[model samples]
Target: MLTLTENAAIAVKAVVAGTPDVQAAGIRIRGAEAPTAGFELTLAPQPEPADAVVEADGARVFLDSTAQAALDDQVLDAQMNEDGSVRFALAAQA
Candidate 1:
């Protein structure tokens, strides 16, 4: 189950709606790779903005076919920070 915060969803929708150079972007709640088991992740970076978003709404979303299992219990959220960087973190999916 994927659960997105209301604020996060709003922020994501607004950003993805107007940005053009942003090939794609999305919050990534990914699991640790090789030799690791617990989950931890960073926001997927976008082609357009690097400093503004913690995660980019990029090809990651489309690649779900390949990575869905890894992202199974994740959530996507958007946050407004005074620092101006979009924040992302792992959460218990409902």
Candidate 2:
């Protein structure tokens, strides 16, 4: 299963709060066509059918089966760059 770090959850929540009509919104993750390609992440108004729902730190995340499989045992983390931009990273569980 995929998991979000505290900072990632906080960031996701903040993003959802800023969007209109996003009370039901959550972070959605999908796998790319190529195995080596990076995953896609966005705020979705709702979960799609058969999506794997994961919750942490009062935030929700929805992932399709393929994404769930690809992110298995992975951790989602967020970091702030020196230029005041936020970057997300995926890493193996410790």
Q: By summed lDDT, which 10 consecutive residues of candidate 2 come out lowest? A: 15-24
Query: In model 1, where is the ten-residue run with the lowest total lDDT?
Result: 57-66
Candidate 1 stretches greater than 4 Å from native:
21-63
Q: Candidate 2 has what TM-score?
A: 0.86
Q: What is the per-residue lDDT of model 1 for residues 33-84, given as tens digits with 9 covering 90 to 100?
A: 6525755443454522322233333223322322345445766665778775
What is the lDDT of every predicted structure here? 0.47, 0.83
Steric clash pairs (candidate 2): none
Error of 1 at 32 (Å): 7.5
lDDT of 2: 0.83
The model with the greatest lDDT is: 2
TM per candidate:
0.46, 0.86
